[model samples]
Target: MAEDLVLDTAIRDWVLIPLSVVMVLIGILRYFVSKLMRSSPAPDAKMVKEGQVIIRARNLKSGANFIPPRSFRTRRLYYSNEENGLLHVPKGQGTNPQAQMFSDPNMAMDMMKKNLSMIIPQTLTFGFVNFFFSGFVAAKIPFPLTQRFRSMLQNGIDLSTVDVSYVSSRSWYFLNLFGLRGLFSLILGDENAIDDTQRMMQMGGLGFDASKSLSAEKDGLDIIQHEWALPRFEQRAESVLRKLVK
Candidate 1:
C-alpha cells in the first residue's frame, strides 16, 4: 500500500509541475509578442534613401563632436555644384575651410553664454526622459519582427500615392524606440552632441521637398520608410551644411 501511495505522489508532481511551467511560458511569450507586433515600423524605398543620408552624415560627423570645448561652432547651408539636387549642400573639395569665419569668436561666446540656461537643462531633460521611455519601449520590441511585418504588410498597401501622414503613422513605433537612444549624449553632458542635434533640427525639413519634386505621389510604405529615417537624415544634412558654412 505504501509503495502504491509513493508512486501516485510522483505521478501527480510530474503532470502538475510541467503543465504549470508550460502555461507560464506561454503567457510570457504572448505578452512579448503583442508588444512587438504593435511596434513594427513600415519601410520602403524612400526610407532606404534616408538611411543612406544618415550613413553619409555619420561619416561627416558635422555636429559639436568636431569642435573644441570653450569654443563655439556656427555653420551655414548652401547648394553644392558637385552633388547637385541634394538638399543639404557641402563646400567644394578644394576650398580653404577656415577663411570663412572672421572676428566671430566673441559673438559666439556671448551667444553660448546666453543660451546656457535654456539649452543645458532643456537638452538634459529632453535627453533623459526621451531616452528612458523610448528605451523601455524599444526593449520590448524586436527589429527582426518589424522587418517580417513590413514584408507581410507591403503586399496590401499601395506603393504609389502614399502620403506623409500615413508614412508618419507607420513609423510611430520606431520613433518610440531608437529615437530614445539618440537622446543620451546630452543627459550624459555631451554639449557638443547637443549643439550638433540642434543644428540638424534647425536645417530645413529633411529632403521632403526633394522627394515631393521627384515623385508627385509616393506610396504608403515609401512615406513610412522616409519619415522613419528622418533622424539619421537630419544628422547627414547637418554635415552637408557644416562643410558649406566653413
Candidate 2:
C-alpha cells in the first residue's frame, strides 16, 4: 500500500506486454476455431419458404394502411388461412407457439454449439494462465479499485495487506480478454473477430435476447392491425381543390 514501494518497471515488458499479446493471440485463434467448428444449418426448402412467407407478410403489414381495406383483408386471409395459408399453422395442435419455440430441436442445438464455442476456450485459457502465472504481480490499474474488486482484480497474488492496485497475471489476462477490441479490429478487421464485450453482455442477459426473439416476432406478426388511409384520399383531394378555388 506504500507509495514508496513501486513495482519494477521491467514487470511491464516481462509480464504485462507478453500477457496482453498472448490473450489477443488466443482470441484470434479462438475466432478461427469457432468458425471451423461452426456448422450453421443451411437454409432448406421449408425454411426458405417460411422465411419468404414471413418477409411477404411483414411487407404487406407495413404497407397495409396504404391499400384499400378490402385488399388488405384479402391478402391477410390469403396468407393467414390455416387450410391453405403459407404459414397457416393449425391452432391447438401443439402447445403455444412460444413454448414450441422453446422446445425446438434446432434452437436447442444452436444454443448448445454457441455456448460450447464460448465456454471451452475460455476454460482452457484461464486454466492454463492460472496454472502458469498464479503468484506473480502482472500489472496495475490506472485508477483505484474498491474492496469488491479486490477478489476479482487480484486473482493469483496472495499478499493480504498489499494494495488492491496490483493485479495478478491471470486477472490481467482476463482484463485483456475484454479490453483488446481496438487491437483485434486492427489485426483482424471489423467483422473478422468477435467482440468479447458484446458476447459477455449477451451471456449476462444485457445483450440481444435471441431466445425469445422468435416468439416476439410471432407476436408482432399476429397483431399487424392496420387502419385504411387510402379511404381519405378522395376527401383530401377534394378539400385541396376547394382551398385552391377559394
Candidate 3:
C-alpha cells in the first residue's frame, strides 16, 4: 500500500489562494471587456417576426390537446397552410450563412470580437500559470478520489505515487476556469459573456437557419393529433362530485 503524502500548509496559502483569486478577477475583467466590445445592432423586423411565428407555432403544437378541435385546427392551418402560411419560406428567400457574413461587415466584425475576447485571455492566463506555478502541487481535496481521476486532477505532476486527490496548479486552473460559471452568473446577469463553455459550444454549432427552423416547426404542427380534453375533464369532475356527495 502507498502512503498518503502530507502537503505543507504554505502551498495552499501561496499557490492555491492566489491562483483562485487571480482567476476570479480575470473572469470579472473578461466579462466587462466582452460587454464593452459587444455591438448592439438594431434587429431586422422581418427576422424578429419570423422567430415569433416559430415560437407561436411551437406553442400551438405543445398545447393542441388542451384547446378545442376547431381552435386547434384554425391555429394549425394558420401556420401549415401550403399557399399562404406564415411558416412557408418562399423560394430564394434563404441566404447562405457564409454569404450573409461576407455581405454584412458588422456581423464579421462581431464574430472577430467574440473570438478575440475568448482566446486572448485564455492564452494569457495559461501562459501566466505555466510560467509561475508549473509543476507545483496547489491543494489536496478533502475526500479520496479514485485512480481514474489522477489524469484529470494531477495534470502537471507526473509521479505515479502521488495521490489522485492532490490537485496540480495546472489542473486547479482548469477547475477554476469551468467552476466559476455560477459565480460569474451571480455577479453578472445570466446572459453575461464570462462562460467559456458556452463560447466553445457556440463556435462548434451551425449558425441558426431561419428557413429550416420555420419548416421544422411547420412539420411539427402538421403531425400533432389534437384531441380536445374538455369533455373528458368535465366527466372526471362529475365523477369526483358524485363521490363527494356520497
Best by lDDT: 3
Model 3 C-alpha lDDT per residue in residues 1-246, reported as the tens digit of each score = 257777788888888899999999998898888888888867989779988998888888878889889989888888889999999888888867777767888777777888998899999999999998889988888888899999999998898888788899999999998888888888888877436777778865536678888999988888887789889999999999999999
In Å, residue 65's CA in model 2 sits off its true spot by 3.5
Candidate 2 at 52: error in angstroms? 2.7
TM-scores, one per candidate: 0.19, 0.69, 0.81
**Across residues 35-124, which tens digit of lDDT does each residue of candidate 1 receive?**
343323344475577456544433333332343322211111111112452333233432232332224464345345434543554465
Q: Write down the TM-score for model 2.
A: 0.69
TM-score of candidate 3 versus the correct structure, residues matched by position: 0.81
Rate residue 234 of model 2 by lDDT: 81
List per-prediction Cα lDDT, in the order shown.
Answer: 0.35, 0.71, 0.85
User: Model 1: which ten-residue window has the lowest total lDDT?
Assistant: 72-81
Give per-model CA RMSD.
Answer: 25.8, 6.2, 3.2
Query: Which residue runs does candidate 3 get wrong by more than 4 Å?
Result: 1-6, 142-154, 157-165, 182-189, 192-194, 236-246
Q: Kindly indicate the candidate among 1 and 2 with the higher lDDT.
A: 2
Quote model 1's TM-score: 0.19
| Residue 78 displacement (Å), model 3 | 2.2
